[model samples]
Structure formats: C-alpha cells, structure tokens
Target: MEILLWIIIIGLFITSFVALFFPVLPSVFAIWGGFIIYHFFLNSGELTTFFWISMVTLTAVLLLADVFTGSLAVKQFGGSKLGGRVAAISVIIGAFVYPPFGILALPFIAVIIVEYWQQEDFLSALRAAIGTLIGFLSGRLAEGIIQLIMIGWFFLIIWS
Candidate 1:
C-alpha cells in the first residue's frame, strides 16, 4: 500500500515538472503537495532532517525563481514598471485561458501591448516583446533543468 501511494506521489511530482511551464499549475506548489501526501499520509517513519530541509528549500527556491525570472524578463526587455505589472497579471490570465502556448504567448502579447502603449512605436514594442520572449524561454529552460534535478533526487531518495 505504501509503495502504491509512493508511486502516486511520484506521478504527481512528474506531472508538476511538466506543468511548470504553464502559468496555471504553480509547479512548486504541486510538487510540495506530493510531499505533503507522503509526509502526512504514507510516510511510515521520520524523514531525515537533511531531507526535509532540502525539500522545503528547493520548493522555496523554485517559487522565487518563478517570480523573479518573470519580473527580470520584463526589466531585461526594457519594459516599464507598469509593463512588468501587466506581465504578471497576464501570466495569471494566460494560465487559465488557452494554456501551453497561451502561457508563452500571453506574456509576450501583454508586454508588447504595454510597451507599444507607452512608447507609441511598433518597432520598439516588437523589440521589447522579443526580449521578454527570450528571457521567458531562458527561465523556462532553467526551471525544466531544476525540475529534472529535483525529480532525480527524489527518485534517488526513494529507491536508494
């Protein structure tokens, strides 16, 4: 029974990793939810202090990365503070509306819209929007790598 529960937890972790790219899923929280199940429900023995600390720390880091990268992307693209704010809101809206592509598209669209509104120039808006896209993609790549590492570490802990 514990093994079955563990498998389910692991599955959730995997799903969370994939869902990290989408704004709607809150990937760090999803992974943490799996741990919550294991800790509160299936865990038969106390986890090591090191294990607990690692898990919590990693989750917090991922959450911070999510917020920081997005805002940084806006700043990197030469966006105004208002643009960053709109990008944040667009991320929330993008998560629920179209998904996957929408996750990537909406932020770009939002940045471009705001940039154009502020700059009143198509070329400048396009440039900043492209920058936002590049930064966003970089962040996504980093998140994917981190999620892979986290999942790999989890597997090591479970199986070893």
Candidate 2:
C-alpha cells in the first residue's frame, strides 16, 4: 500500500514537471505538493515538521512570484487594465495557437498592436508592450527558479 502511494506521488511529480512547459497547467505546484505530502506522511525522514514548514513557505513564494510578475511589468510600462487583460487573454489563446514562444510573444505582440490601435500612438504603445513583456519575462524566470528550488527540495527531502 505504501509503495502504491509512492508510485502515485511520483506520477504527480512527473505530471507537474510537464506543467512547467505547458502553461495551462500548474505543474510546479503539483510537483511541490507531491514532495510535501510524501515527506510529511510517508517518507521516513528527519525534521518532518520543519521540512513541511519550509515547504509551505516556499510554495507561497512560488505562487506569488507567478501572479505579480506580469502585472508589475505592465505597470512599469504604463499599461492600463484594459491593455493588460487583453494581453493576458492573448497569451492564453496564443498558448493554444502556438506553444512556448506563442505564449511568450503574444503579450509583446498583442499589446503593441492593440495599444497602438487604441491610442493611435506608436511610441506609447511600444512602451506599454515592452513593459508588459519585460515584467512577464522576469516573473516567468523567477517562477522557473522557484520551481527548480522546490523540485530540489523535494528530491533532497526524499533522498535524505
């Protein structure tokens, strides 16, 4: 029974890893969940309570990093709510239409085109788009790093 549970946990970990690339899924968090649950309930290990505390804290940071990143960037670029929402939707749609690059480029391209259309000013629209992209990229990069840390924590906890 314990072995079966471990197998289930491992499967979730792999699924979450795929979410890392797939945008639509919350893969990193899933991986975090697998490690956290296993370490707390099943894995015969040391510092179980402290480990969970650190895991929970790290998970909070990981989630927040993803959420605030794009908006912060958009704000820096002087993008409005309308522009940000539109850009965000475009990114999701782009994920289906393209892939990783599609996910990444949709914001930069979509915001530029839309903002330009709305304001009829090339330079201003360009600024907003650039800001949106920069913020998004930074956040995405941070998310990747957080995911890495979480995954590392998972493995180290499991192995130890």
Candidate 3:
C-alpha cells in the first residue's frame, strides 16, 4: 500500500506538470492535490509547516503569473489597456468555448480586433496580437518551469 501510494503521488505530479500547457487544466490545483495526497496517505504528519507555506506560495505565484503575463505582453507590444483586457478576458472565455486551442485562438483574435478598433491600423493590430501570443507562451513556460521546481522540491522532501 505504501509503495502504491507513492506511485500515485508521483503520477499525479507528472500529470499536473504536463497539464500546465493546457489552459483548461487547473495545474496548480493538481500540484496542491498531490501534496494533499502525500500528507494524508504517504506520510501523515510528516510535512512541516514550512512545506505548507512553500506550497501555498508556489501556487499563488504561478496563478498570478498566469493572470498577469498576457496583459503585460499585450501592453508591452503597444496594445491599449482595452486590448489587453480583451485579450485576457477572451482567454477565459475561450477555455469554456473551445478548450485548449480556443484559449490561444480567441485571445489572438480578440486582441487584434480590439487593437485595430483602437488604432485603425492593420499592422499595429497584428503586432499586438503577436505580443499577446508571446505573452501567453511565456506564461505557460514560466508555469511549467515552476511546476517542475515545486515537484523536485517535493521529491527532495520525501527522499531526504
């Protein structure tokens, strides 16, 4: 049973890490869930207070990264506040409307439309759209790297 539990926990962490790329998956929650599984099943009462705090902090930081990066990217690329806001909003709506790809497509379309509406220039709008794409990709990369670090830390905790 102990071996089985450890296997499950590891599997969950791997799934959580891979899920970071998919907008629809709550990858942060998956990592947290793996921690909970460890605390309850594999080593009850073994996790330290510091571990809990670190877990929460990691989750919060990743969540903020996901929420802010797109807007920052849009603005960095000369997109207006309205364009950035639309891009961010479209991502959420896109997740519900399509799923993985929609999350990317809807934001690009929305940002371009809003940028063009504001600037009335096709090239400028396209640039902003590209920025939004870069922002979204960067956000995913950041989350994936953080998730790997967090999982590595978890393994260290368990093995050490």
TM-scores of all predicted structures: 0.85, 0.79, 0.88
Q: Over the full model, what C-alpha lDDT does candidate 2 score relative to the true structure?
A: 0.75
Candidate 3: clashing residue pairs, number: 0
Q: Is candidate 1 or candidate 2 better by lDDT?
A: 2
The digit string of per-residue lDDT tens for model 1 on 26-116 reads 5766676776777789663545678778977876776677667767877776777787777778767887888877767887898899899
lDDT of each: 0.74, 0.75, 0.84
Please give the TM-score that candidate 2 achieves against the real structure. Answer: 0.79
- What local lDDT does model 2 show for residue 126? 90
Please provide, for model 2 over 9-119, each residue's C-alpha lDDT reduced to its tens digit, 9 standing for 90 to 100: 788777765664467876666776677567667855653777678877877887787677777777778777777887778777777877877777787888988888888
Report the Cα lDDT for residue 124, model 1: 76
Ranking by TM-score: 3, 1, 2
Error of 2 at 110 (Å): 2.0
RMSD of each: 2.1, 2.8, 1.9
lDDT, ranked from best to worst: 3, 2, 1
- TM-score, model 1 to reference: 0.85
Candidate 1, which segments miss by more than 4 Å at Cα? none
Model 2 alpha-carbon drift over 4 Å, by segment: 1-17, 36-47
